[model samples]
Target: MQISQQDVHQALERGEFVPHFQPIIRLRTGQLYGFEMLARWAHPELGLIFPGDFIEQAERDGWISELTYQLLRKGLKEIAPLPGEPTLSVNISPPQLHGTSFVDQVHEAAAEANFPLNRLILEITESALAEDIVSVSKTVQSLKIAGCRLALDDFGTGYSSLLHLQSLPFDELKVDRSFVSSMTQKHDSRQIVAAVVGLGQSLSLTTVAEGVETEEQAEILLWLGCELGQGWLYGKPVPAEQLDEMMKRRQPHASNAILNGMTGRQSATALEIPPMQRFAQLRAIYDGAPVGLAFLDREMRYLSINRRLAAINGSPMEEHLGRTVAEMIPEFFPTVRPLIERALAGEVVAGVELTKPTQNPKELRTILLSYEPAFDESGEVIGVSVVLLDITPIKRAEEAQRESEAHFRHMIELIPQIPWIIDPEGRALDVSQRWLELTGVNDDQWRGFAWLDSLHPDDRQPTIDAMHRSFQSGEPIDIYYRVRRSKDHPWQLLRSRGSARRDDNGEIMCWYGSLEIIGESDAGKK
Candidate 1:
């Protein structure tokens, strides 16, 4: 029988939504790292409902947050009784990452369960990163402050995955199951897995391969320097009641005893090459970076610099070595020296803007400076690694945009008709001063659907219908409306025309329109 949405809602209240565990094993050591908790519906009439059947439905019905908290509570209660600090990973839906209560609720659940936050892992999918990234970032920071770990689930599936990896404080990068499962047969899949592992190694992140079902896959992942695996080969996701027995059955012998068919010491030694390869890749990335990269010694002399940085300094890369910043780029030196000094003092710095004059007298160049403290083996601050991004273009673009907007507003004041702009969804983006003056209101009051409030009551419905038709047809709309400056002023007939602002592809980017008074209203004649 197909279940109605109500059935799932009731199931949640009845506490039918529970967590199941899947083991994540350390590939190199063959030791159990943790258990990833998955949600299952323990329905009385139905045997068990997997997350696939109801996860999206819960999100759509606006209960994903509650469902997630329920799972966390149930899973924590079940896992608290287990031995050791084995991690418990739970998937966080996109909705749960937003709003105010998510972090507080999780803190409440963990506190009530008496589970250590360090061993709790919250897995987030790449898609979640796209929605309110600021919220996601704040959530990550808060969870980290609480000593909880975060995993980027299904890595490499999204376009901005790499950017997220750079920006967010993620503890784990999960290799998507599709790549892990296809590694043995598809060369591209295997390469992708290797690249992800290599990337994780470079970033010092624990890389986990999902859906590893065969020995060959594990072998390849281990060779690629990926140390964690999760899938059927380790064990299917099982109920918490069955966990203790499984743990006992799978406990490592002789402290993670060597797996069969491999010389343990040799296998461990062979894993060394990937790190060297990873370092080489990291170096290549550093050298070819779009921004300027350099290392400044304690004395503020250039220890190393990339070609891009050299180009920015108007000097050769090799020539930059052993020269003080003051000697190399006299103009840039004074501005950046203080930031480098801070890093040399063991303080990391970022986003310190440095502005200098370019060769052209009229132009100024701006670079965003970020510095990392380099440390020696003895734990002393050795030098500073500096990253300089020339953001002059972005700054210039922003300035030019501001000037353009000012110019547009000036032109709008000079025009006889009131001008307006709206997004494709009909949300008012901008309206001219004329409209605001005529309506005896501010533009803020007319944003979104509220713009209809300014129209004469009878004309509002007709205007909406006309806009709908125009949007649907992607055509110009010519319509009439009635409005007055105030209740004391007689209503006047106005002509409004709006047309789609199309791009090169003929896709509507927004709607631009103008309104003008054509005649006095019927009420004024009366």
Candidate 2:
């Protein structure tokens, strides 16, 4: 039998949504790490309805947030009280990250369930992260700040780049199941899996190999350095009741069984944590690349260098040690000499700005350069330890975001109808100049609930009621309200329509609306 959208809607109203837990395993020890909670509909007539059928439709119908919240609540209910405080990974939708009050709703949901935020892992897709990364990144950062971890799902499936990984924070990297299922049969897929694992190791991200259906795939992934695996080989997704029993029966594979569900935030912000403590793992994986590391003698001659720094400086690692910094790159030596001098003088210099050569010579790479004075056992200065993390993409992303915001504001101003924005609570956030010009009020006078005072006496109460109804129902507001052009002028009929901007949890974060004079060609012209 075919299922209609209405069937799905009714299922949600009757509280039919439930969480199905899939096992994620720690590869090295064959121990269970955590479960990824997937959403399912327990239809009275149709049995468990999977998300692939209804999730997109829900989002299209503007009710995905409701679905997300219900699943989150049900999932939290199932696991929050379990022993060992097992980590739970939940997939977050794109719309929730883009405009919905996802950040606030998540914190609220976890708090309501008395769940620990650190044990929560939010899995985001690469495609979603690529869409409007600037806005999504801010929302993601807020989640990170709240102690929630993030995982980048479907590692090689979308248009993700090394830059995307560096700019947006992620705690775990999942090699998409397609690669794992095909790795043994396809050479390219195996190489991709190996590369992703290396990327994860370099960035201190816990790599989880997905869709490992066979022992051979698991062994190959483990050999490729992936620490986690999730698929039928471990166990298929089951109801929470079964999961609870499994959790109780299973002991940690090793005394130090890897809890790979969550890891620390991996981003430039990680730099704020003590350099040595933060970079210790990074230094150990010096061969993995991403960051450039090197050591120079007191005379500024290269003593040791990693392959990445050698490639970056357009020189071989062996040649780097024999040649002095000036001899290797005379162009950059002048700018770096001062910072090097400071390190040699026993001063630890950090965040020293430096430029690097990119493929496009016109566009130089931005480097967050740090230099620390290396010391001997006797406390005498030996050399300078250098760490160069390229941040050019991050800088370029910021510039692009600024330009996009300017364009958005310009577009908002150009529309004929008067545009305005409001907080979820109905307080004015922005009232376009057009509204002010027509009303003969300054921007300050037009903002906040004070604008309600200018409504025609008879329309004020009705307008307030309409706003409340819309805010309460998460529906669009549309009404013919009357407002005076001036205190002395007669009331003019206006058509206003606004809708709630919801986060993934069905919580309103803000409202966007526009106003038009009923008879006038343009609100501003009138």
Candidate 3:
């Protein structure tokens, strides 16, 4: 049963409604970066009810704005005692934001708490402002004018264009957690997140990704160039008291000091090597290594460069060292900036292909680059180590193969009938360009599974079984099948042949097969 507005009010009077704090972290740095305040209701009989259960109900009863105000006051009261006073992000309902006196209430709340308005982060969803943006824009602007932080929450999953985003005047962008969680596994999600992050960076806005739960997700986000992030992987929501306790337990043991040109946090007087010797050793390994290597400060400037990497930059090692990547390779700046920024924020980037400028005037070399955080032994990341491996030959070979395939495609396009190719596994390996052109199907989307879409249900299994045998036994096999082209068109008959190819080890590697159109009009009518 839903509680009444009066009942909710009574509960609030008795100090039942409160805020729960969830920690957000910078992926590269393990420090407590920020906190998102979640609303919670501690019921006497029901134990505890999360916002998911009661927040909308309160809104229906027209008491959510009042509840939110009370929670904000409670949140600030708890945050004030913290040592560093980390940024506090709170979710704001669109109704509340658009309500009259909303700006006044927020200002009065901050003034009463004597809190820094800049540290208060207000988050709002795109859906909430979908109805009327004019009023919403004014409301948000007024908040920002009052010296409060503004964030466009739940970015993506909306039709709102860049025009809406620009009009919001948001200072931070909280990428929808769905995109952040799925980015590592899906290309579409990765592209979407990358685009959003790019938009944020171009506007000089801080981008925070939510729902980061694993190291892989964190690594991908870092590689994609996101800055601040929050998720269960960092820390789940907790009470203010619990947050304080957790901080105390995890705080560093020492304040960290610098001694003899090295950041010193370890004990003095044992197995000490000269700083110059250490630097020299690092530089020596870097110079002689077959793989390219370089050092970068937090801002992604080349702190040191080795001969191999310098060759990739088309300059002397000394000349390229100490330069920003944007300066050395301006063309790659847009694509690589996020990575450098993520590394600067304390995240490792591995297995990313970076196109580098080479000494050959017109050539570009693709290299696999990995960047790891570098510390001065004080556990604070001061710079990064970059390793680059040339993969130009591999890339060139792949391109040549693609070009040859394109030529074969052109040849197939000239044929009168649809043609197709399949591997031994009965999966579509390739299809004639004419078949795709006539069917209005994308050639790139013609993956193994898609070929099934073209076959008659009755003939599909038989065709597949025969192809499997041909591949497994290294024999030439032929079969007849009826293929469905379109719902309005009759099933067309076809003759398919399969031939197997084996590697030097005599293990079957692939099946080369073709489907040739055959009908009553054709002589090969079998």
Top-scoring candidate (TM-score): 1
Give lDDT tens digits, candidate 2, residues 1-526. 4557787678878989888998787776666677899988888877877889777887677778888898888888788987767789999888888764788788888999999999899999987887799989888999999999999999888885676789988999999999899887776787789899888887889899888888668767765668788888777888877876877666543212222342223221332344346467766687576788999998999877898888778888889985789999899999999999999989999998777778887888888889999964224577999998878889899999999988987887898888878887778998877777677777688678978876767778888898899888888989887776775565667899988888998788899999988853223223
Ranking by TM-score: 1, 3, 2
Name the TM-score of candidate 3: 0.50
RMSD in order of candidates: 27.7, 32.2, 24.0
Total residue pair clashes for candidate 2 = 3
Candidate 1 C-alpha lDDT tens digits along 1-526: 3567788679877998888999898787777888999999898987898989888878887888888989999898888777767889999998888866889988999999999899898999999999889988888888889899999999999869988989988999999999988777776787788899889987888999999888777777776778788888888999978988897898542112235465666655655556767578878998989999998888888888899988878889988999998999887777777877888889999999878778998998888889999864224676889888999999999999999999988987997888888888888888888887788777588888788787888888898898889999998989998887788877778899988999999989999989987977766332
TM-score of each: 0.51, 0.49, 0.50
Cα lDDT computed for each candidate against the true fold: 0.84, 0.80, 0.75
The better candidate by TM-score, 2 or 3, is 3
**Model 1 residue 64 distance off true place after TM-score fit, in angstroms:** 0.8
**For candidate 3, lDDT tens digit of each residue in 243-284?**
768777754221112133433322222213343565678778
lDDT of 3: 0.75
lDDT score for candidate 1 against the true structure: 0.84
Q: Is candidate 1 or candidate 2 better by TM-score?
A: 1
Stretch of 10 with least lDDT, candidate 2: 255-264
Residue pairs with backbone overlap in model 1: none
Q: Which candidate has the top score in lDDT?
A: 1
